[model samples]
Target: MIMTKELWEGNAAIAEAAICAGVEAFFGYPITPQTEVLEHFSKRLPEEGRVFLQAESEVASINMVYGAACAGARVMTSSSSPGVSLMQEGISYIACSEVPAVVTNIMRGGPGLGNVQPAQGDYFQAVKSAGHGDYHMIALAASSVQEAIDLMVLAFDLADKYRTVVIFIADGAIGQMMEPAEMPPLRPVRPPEERVAWALTGAKGREHNIITSLYLGAENLEQVNLRLQAKLKKIAANEVRWQEYSTEDADFLLVAFGTVGRICQTVVREARAQGMKVGLVRPITLWPFPSARIAELAGRVKGILTVEMNAGQMVEDVRLAVEGACPVRFYGRMGGVIPLPDDILPELDKLDAGVASGREVQS
Candidate 1:
């Protein structure tokens, strides 16, 4: 099959990629930067005779996804920050139930009703667990439109492979921006006979299948939690994905993800041209973060600078990964403000000076 690159907006690309991945249904509410995802699916899915629902609220949308997932259908939902928060309870239910589902969070700013601008403020909520209880969803962060498209496809596969929730978190910038990208070829929808063994298709020929997050017995709930933990360990061991640039011989490193990660590449290039050795570690998977790689890089670099579009959320993870091997500093622009190369270079300079002067600087 021939593949051609075409200009694509990030939100629309996410919907298109889901369709290409054979998403059987999409249940979503309209939210900025991500409303396009729902709109795209609304038009495309119905045309293809697939489900496209505009639920009254994020609460309704997530539960719809949960029901479809239990039926072993490829299901998804999209929302921004506040809308996602509303779905937390449903998300936890889906996680505990161990059904496969895809959730797309085109993140915006805020602890409350923040603006519909690009921000990584949801980092902690997403990676630490989007809802209550001791459960986690596979979280993937995309830095570009192309990566957003690719990760949407990967999210579905990962969700099915793990039989768990997968959250694809892309900042509002990516959702709003447009770039040239290649959409994956369409995949045929899995027939009922091909659904997973655990699906609730029917119990005619076999024992009934019960899918629920509620384990009323104390021992039963403990066992369920243990199984979830084991699954997370497996995911961490096998799914820690990240990209490194210019680290062969570097005095300093830039650690970031999503839009900030993309911007740091420019900082690395400019810093190199000015005779400063710099490198970057852009994490693709936020949950099973690239901690091991960052630790190794910490051992060799003079210092690490973590840049983010939030008030330094991911920096905490970087600090843990560094483990005092070297000074880890954070620089961030919060409340929907994006940090450009100009905004970040001075922070790197400060980290360099602190390292040179045997001092530590914190963000």
Candidate 2:
């Protein structure tokens, strides 16, 4: 189907994409950099006979999402950093119950209600089982408005495919930035048959299906944990995605994700123009992080540099990906500050010189 292209903020693009993907319910609270998403949905979704609720709190909103998703409906909710933190308990519950839902975290400065602007401080939280107990969430990072739309659709599919919660992670810059977007026609998503088997949609004619994470017996919980581990292994083997630029003959690889990855794209271009064989590795799925791909490149490259808005959360992941194969270093700024491409150039130069100086340190 033909799609019309128009300029839209990332948050608005996500909301529009969700509607096009047949999302029937949205529950969220107002939070900066992400409020535009709920605002757009509130105005547009009802026109399609869908539900949009501006919940009393982030906690209440996430619970509403949990309820709707449990009923076998496509559900979504969004919030900024602090608000996302408030929704953690519900998210954990969703994870434990193995419910399919979309949670968008338009991140800002962290540790507290730090700022209303963009930041990438929640990298670890997004991928590291934020709620609790041997559960994993599928995490997708969007670098542009188009990506926001594209990945939102992918997020819903993955959530259902895995029968787990999924996160669409973008920073404030992506959330607020306006760019050309194509709104694709809606295609019906077949509701998962398992949802009907397990979901609580009233007694009906069959025996009641209970959705709970609580398993009192240690052996039963151990079996569940084993099953989850196997699932994660399958995801790691098949689901990791990343984008590479100018890696054909590069000595240094610059790694970043989300909006920071977009910024690094420009840096990679400039560095190549100045006769530097520098490349970039941008992770698309942060949870099933493209570790094998990164590890494969580590054998061919001289060093890896991780750039982010936060101090060094994602850097740790890069280090793990490389696994002492090469030097991994970090350069970042925190608390709503963004690192400009120009500012990054000097660090690139220093890394180049450090590699040349024959004192390469393994990250």
Candidate 3:
């Protein structure tokens, strides 16, 4: 197949990628920095005879996604930070019910109703706890338009494979930025016969399969929790993914994800140009968190700096992974601020200075 590269805005590229991945249904509401995803689906999905509905609100959209997912349809939704927060209850329901669904979050600034500027403030919400549950969803973070497209496809596959919700997360910058990206060849939606055995399809010759997150009995819920925990363990073991840049020999390591991770790559190069041994480790799978790799690098690198667009969420995870093997510091810009290489280099310099002085690197 001759795959042609085309320029696309981040949000539109994600919507197109979902279509190429055989999304049978898309339910979403309009929201800044991510509304394009819903708009794109509105036009394209209908042309292809797929389901596309702009629900009344994010709550309605996610519930619609839950219903479609229960029927084993490849369903998806897109939203920004506050919009995603509105869908949390439904997201948690999808989690415990063990339904495969895809959710794309083009994260914007917020603790609540923050601006539409790009921000990674949703890191904790995306990676730590999607909703009020002990369950986990596979979270994939993208740093570029091309990666956003690629991970959108991966999100659907992983969602089906694990029978869990998968979140394709990126800062708003990635959603609005336009870049050349090679889309995957279009794939056909799975046939109804290919749907999972547990789908809520009409019962015929086989025993009816019941799926629900509500287990009123305490003991019954415990068993369900145990099963979910086991599944999470399996995912963490098998799905940890990260990229290492110039880590072959380094005195310092820069750890980040999404847009900040992309910036840190430039930080590594610029620092190296000045004869500093700096490297970067960018986590792609945020939940199955590449912790083991960071732990190993911690033992070798003199210090690690975690740069983020949040106050400092992922840094906690980084600190945990390091386990005091070395000093772990944090630098961040909140409320839709994008941290440039220039802003990050000085932080790296401080880390270097602290390490050289044998002083503790403050986070």
Candidate 4:
């Protein structure tokens, strides 16, 4: 029986969003705190005449997604930290093949098999090097269940539009939390037969479409890489997204994304109540990373502080954005630890101290 509850856990909401967005096939293995994504799909997709495969491992799951994607199906896969690590090779193949697929990481803490709690430690993996390639995915980060639903829909369209991978990075907290969300209006899945122009259907009346990542010749491979880089540059120029909160007049800025960005938003409001001139810059799209906006903010603010769930991954990008125009400081809580608003304010406060000293804050 379908649970018609008004409140939805984040994973469940995402699954429903996928169905509404016309996701035709899902290939994934269950991992926590994200198994709910699989659970929801296993029960709901078949009801809508869609396909769901519980693969043997994250490796098998992603390759399966790659195959289905090559067939021009709207496909998806998801996992937590360790599982996501195992799928990197398959991700590389999908990138080079230029297939459209959506991979969501409901992040948990990790070095290997860390823990089943919320953390934003996958920023580097998702943004810096999604796979072993000089390619980029349309990386989107969601703060609330509604945004998660909305982004999942956008993720599919963007993947199909660009013929590239799109990643949705949500932390374990967002994966497991209950929130009221309205599903997007339904859209019908396009028939695979209609995609014969690109899909690998048996050649009957047209040119055989070959979908492989192999390029043995040096010059041919270099040209392919160059075109992919062109696509990435265009995506970066067109898709960089962020929100400026109380930033028009601020002395220090808190730079964050994903879940930390949500917390920092409250820190902005509360800090303003206390008469502190601090603001927040939350990156909405993590890969095309809104760096230009961060750079502009650096010129406007006295200093910037990066808050993360790891020692400091995204801080490197934030520093790159600022380019030493202002000091950038990092404060992190690792291994499944979620930072509170209070935990972040002190870090933003420290940026001023470093600015006052004129000595760069050492990481």
- Give the alpha carbon lDDT tens digit for every residue of 68-109 in model 4: 988888999998888989999999999999999999999998
What 10-residue stretch in candidate 3 is worst by lDDT? 354-363
lDDT of each: 0.93, 0.88, 0.93, 0.88
- State in Å the error of residue 124, model 2: 0.9
Q: Which residue pairs come into collision in candidate 2?
A: none
Alpha-carbon RMSD to native, per candidate: 1.1, 1.7, 1.0, 2.3
Please provide, for model 2 over 1-363, each residue's C-alpha lDDT reduced to its tens digit, 9 standing for 90 to 100: 676799998889999999888798899999998999999999988888788999999999999999998888889999998898888899988887788999999999977878888999998889996776777788899998998899998988888788788999999999999999998788664455535567777778888888888889999989888887887788778788889998889888999998889999999999999998899999999999988889999999988989999989888888998899988889999998999899888888888888889776664
Clashing pairs in 1: none
Misplaced by over 4 Å in model 4 are 1-5, 359-363
Compose the digit string of candidate 1's lDDT tens values, residues 1-363.
999999999999999999999999999999897999999998999998899989999999999999999999999999999999999999999999999999999999897988988999999889998688998889999999999999999999999999989999999999999999999999999986788889899997899999999988999999999999999999999998898899999899999999999999999999999899999999999999999999999999999999998887899999999898999999999888999999889898999888888887442
Off by over 4 Å in 3: 361-363
Order of candidate numbers by lDDT, starting with the best: 1, 3, 2, 4
Cα-based TM-score, every candidate: 0.98, 0.96, 0.98, 0.96
Please report the candidate that would top lDDT against the real structure: 1
lDDT of 3 by residue, 1-363 (tens): 999889999999999999999999999999998999999999999999999998999999999999999999999999999999999999999999999999989998888888999999988888887699798889999999999999999999999999999998998899999999999999998898888888988898989888788999999999999999999999999998899999999999999999999999999999999999999999999998999999999999999999999999999999999998999999999998899999999998999899899886544
